[model samples]
Target: MIDTKKIRKFFPAIKAGRIITNNAASTQVPVQLLELLKKLVVQYDNVHRGQSHSSILTTEEFESSYDTIAQFIGAPSRKNIILYRNATEAINAVMYSLMTEFKDGDNIVTTFMEHNSNYVPWYGLCKEILPKFGINVEYKIVKFDTETGALDLDHLKSLVDQRTKIVCCSGASNFLGTINPLKEIKAIADSSGYLQPNGDKRSYLLIDGSQLVPNTYVDVGELDIDFLVWSFHKMLAPFGVGALYAKEELLLKMRPFLYGGDMIAEGMVSPEKVAYNSLPWKFTAGTPNILGTILSSQAIRLLMDFSLNPGKQKYFMTDKKLERKDVKKAMDNIEVHEKILIGEALKILGDISSLNIYGPKTAANRTALVAFTCKNKSPFEIAEKLSNLGIESRAGCHCATLAHRYYELNPPASCRLSFYIYNDIEDVRKACLAVKKCI
Candidate 1:
């Protein structure tokens, strides 16, 4: 069995008696991940344009992170991975790229269950200027039954049609904790690895992997996703860093969302002779977040292989030593343990007549996130009450406004308690106790 205690030991945030159940909002940073950020802040001063040894070394470290994360996700290579400020920017990059062909009549199929980060952008893109570009974008949301969050793949098939251009979805929902049926959805779209005169690439299946990346080893090749994005901040990395993965040829086609220096190969003051930078850099203008990227790299490396502790430094990069199967097995083992904890929590919470949960009825189709509602208590009030009891939980809509509306939870929202690989039975017990106190 994977040693969860050893993993939990690395996250000092658990020291306070608060059970941090809001992992869907933000995860507890492990000590190893924190140290890498500290090293970047404490020692490194250069970002992007530094020419000194520290700058060069740190740059190498930052660029190396792109490769490490790319390899972890099984991307074609690091070149396809471009650094952005966060998942929002990453999403914007994809939307901005689509500015060219999208017209008023064309529809984009997305879901209601998306975090605002995913939902709002498409909404804005569809509403704001799509008509000017001739695209009348319509949202075909996928909501689940109150009994379970088994995503409506059948409903999705009905929405996707000849006019549909893009299908954006979350790799995993942040609130309901439901894994989407993307591959199945792709099959409905008739989107297979199609023949590209330039290269092999199918239509788009962009996954917002923000909530799913740190917990899962997602092989991009296996999924055949046309695009994917996630936040480094969520993945035990520093803030201000995220990734946008696109087929290089597709990246070559999209327009830059923002314009500034470093994005242009050479541009003129006048429009007479403006030259945009080639693939990748064409989208990323100005100086990049080098330090954050470096920190993110180190953090990802540590999570991928925890043995690479900073000072001790001998335990990491089993990239060669340990096969991907071993890592998946360890993660799988931990997932099984988490499922047990979730079951215990459900059984305990179900006994309380006032309490209710949203998502899959069992752990079979669910994730670590447990979203619930207590009668006569605002979800936020429940969360605050739990906080006072030293139980850290999430309240409000959990950024899943669509789910809030779909579940008929109304303005009060639902409480979310998510666990990572590190959590044990005791944490579940504490959460149960805290809920009792809150009630």
Candidate 2:
């Protein structure tokens, strides 16, 4: 078991007696990261646009931040990582960058289990924007088993044909709390011999890892995914930073999502010809979030240190390069801890007769969240009552509208209790007991 007492001390929210069980949306920032933020302010300056010593220092930190993030996900290098506002924006960036690649006969395949951020952008691409231009692209959604919350692999396989351009899926369902079989999905995508602009003959796979990456180890290289997106805020950093990881070749061939300012190569822009900057920077336009970038990277470092040696500061506020084994060990520990917490939550909440839980019944098959609804109580009312009892919970589709609707929930919402590294068994008990009281 993880040292919850030691872990709780790092987060002021836990100390303040707030039972923070809504971690799927965003995690509370640790005091270490807060302190790092303060340190960054004194040395703050815009990166790649100044000559001051502070600018140079901040620039190095910001750039190295990419390396830290890339290494955490087992990406090849910083070239594969692009920062965005959130996972939603990161996925949209992929849509925008690859917008021109769609053809008249092409289609995209997603699923009913996706968060709206993953589904709506494709919906707009195929149904709205592409149709307006007279491009006859289609978007197909695969279904999951209503009872099991498992993806219909056969249905997913049937949706991909030679004309399928891209396959979008969530790494884990935020609402259903199911961990998808990505390698199986990747195999299905690979079998679809869809030709691409880059001469590739398979559908590109994009995993919306907003939920997966924060709770488990996600090696982009090992998974062999063409693209992956997630947010730092979900992993204990403050808001305003997210990440997109794509293959180096894809980033090289795709169009830049945004254009202006520093994305252009130094002294390479003119009326006659314009050139873009190298690799990751081409995707980052204008003034980037330098301070947030630094803090987010340090957040990963701090998480590693916290997992490996709780309450100690080995990796945070240091310049050490993260080792691959350490990343695996830290993430594995986190995954196990979360499994235990979620298992206990499922048990406690399952005991309530009127409460209908969504997603995989086994914690081994799901992420660290439990989303459910009580038959006689509206989800919003239950969530409000839980709040009154000083317990935190989320009520809504939790942005997984498609999944919520798939379950045929009236008003289409659920009450969710999610746990993180700092959350202990006691917190889960209180949240579950409060849920019982609310019902």
Candidate 3:
């Protein structure tokens, strides 16, 4: 199956005797991506602003990076891709762009299991921002099953109605580790007969794919999502680049999230009026993270290569357009590998007396992460002890405050261990055994 030995060589972190299991926050960059970053720095320049050869070359790579990201996710084209600082900012962009569109009586539906990035934006929009403007748009949160950590689709259906303008949900929970059924969620969102300015008869679906995109293959066209957001750091790339993929039609009609130079068409501005640039650039305002964007795109290529040919460099540096089948094959292999790792983690950690695991018990129902709480043991203390044992773990709300409150956790915390491509069965065993030692 997966060559863990070969894959571990690409990441220098594993060689340094570091057990990097806290991957849900951010993954370590491979040596390949680090080299790519080094190569990009010499010729770096601001995109769309300079006429030098370096500018043109860097712009070419930067723009092509969008194509790579879009192709990886099965988006139609680069026109549908928009770059942001992170997934949170991308979701906020949607909220601001559609702020004026929400009527007084309309409501937004989201799940209780969502990361704060998804929930807090809508909460601020409906409760804080819109209220000051005299708009009373309501935000309704659907509950989940506490035992299984699964979204209650019936409750979601009950929450969505004709007045629901948007439905936002996470593709996977960072704390609970549950992979939500997006297609079924889309079906429910589509049934909401909310009239929009674009003449659409259903609510728009926005998926927070920060966790799901890194672990599984996501096809936006097939899923019929209006918007999708994810961060590159969670994958193999470094920080400072996240992606937003929306339908071209939606990007064309919706207002620009940020406005500045290069967003306007050349020479189309006058004292009287100004015209905006075309599809993707209109959304990209000021200077972007050129080096980070290139590395992020190359990270996708490297991930594909790693999945297909573990130790080889078949697709990493190539400029070839990524094929859909190759993406599916690579993601499927990663999914299977992660499932085995998480399954072992669940088995080993579940053996500990009084340790309660969150999310689905089966590996198939969740991503490659395990969060748990124990009786009479503080999660923070457990995490600290695991750290002393050289086992990396996260202990906090994990940006899932609502879900922690839902479970009635006293300190609003749980210990989590998440895996990536470089992690193997041994890594899971050590992390779990460390947890056992802590308890």
Candidate 4:
């Protein structure tokens, strides 16, 4: 029910006669954001370090950007939000911030379906960092069902115990396109009898929402999540900006991941002691990505406008506070639209006998992406052929090496075609037919 014809007009990539279906890796930038970038270049200035008129104006936009991002995800406030280079850095921030809190026998529980960003940091922490300090921390990886691509919750329950410090999982699988059951995962994390330094009796839950947040609505307060990380690049903005939403209490207790200028309090540093800045700022170090932050926040507003009323400026470039109802409606529309697109894709791609599709069989249980391997064709060859046919697709592990290895793929790869709001049914049809033709 999304007016894809109208939505496609906002993207230059679509107008260039190129099919952009590689959205799981990164979405194409909209023309509005491009124009907004041009306008921002005129008055660009470093925030929080200058007294000039341009600096003050730019600082206001940069700081208000936090408010917009916080509002979009139903975060309590800007205090709980921290901006990073990308989702990988955000996850690393959590790992580093809580590095010292791990006990000798503590374990971190994660899934086999996680992207490297979610798994590697914990791996490095347990294998490389903690052992140097004589702390014998362990990491446990939960398994998923190979047939349905569903997470094995019973196995996750068996892995978690009193010693489990944190539970990390992806909100959706990039390769399988599986939308994980977060509430169920949260419940499992809560039941773990791990006593925390903060007097909590459960493991902290961190969700890597790089795939989920961009495609669906996520409310931090409602979910009671300890940490959430995602990249704006996958959500329609340009690269160089990612987000971390943690509980304010947890952010206050954890150490800063990076430290330098801007993180320290103004005029508070002395030879004896140096105090850090307030919440959110404490985690942000050095000169931040000023223009990227502004454009990224504006992208959220523009996305709502694109879903609700295309070619209209109700939310974009405005200072109005985003209502929770409007956010839900906008995201619900997107989820529904994606279901239709993925449903059509599943129907067409399922008919190919040589193609073996991964993830949920139905659109209701997954995101708007499909990854498959051909019986006689290499995934790389299929992707190259699709590119030659004017279609965009991704081939490789898609940074999902663990999942690919789980399936026992020799090259540990698959060809992926992902859809976004701007992608139409015709695009899905052409892309699937092209895959059939390629194989």
What Cα-based lDDT does every candidate model obtain? 0.71, 0.93, 0.93, 0.94
lDDT of 4 by residue, 309-412 (tens): 88889999999898899999999999999999999999999999999999889998899999999987899999999999999999999988999999999899
RMSD of candidate 4 to the truth, in angstroms, is 0.7
lDDT of 4 at 435: 91
Candidate 4's C-alpha runs over 4 A off are none
Superior by TM-score: candidate 1 or candidate 2: 2
The deviation in Å at residue 355 for candidate 4 is 1.0
Q: Give stretches of model 1 more than 4 Å off.
A: 41-50, 132-134, 191-203, 266-271, 307-323
TM-score, cand. 2 = 0.99
- Per-residue C-alpha lDDT of model 1 across residues 304-325, encoded as one tens digit per residue: 4542232334434233433456
What TM-score would each prediction reach against the true structure?
A: 0.89, 0.99, 0.99, 0.99
Candidate 3 pairs with clashing backbones: none
1 versus 4: better TM-score goes to:
4
Per residue, candidate 2 scores C-alpha lDDT tens digits across 136-181 of 9989999999888999999999999999999999999999999999
Inter-residue clash pairs, candidate 2: none
Worst 10 residues of 4 by lDDT: 1-10
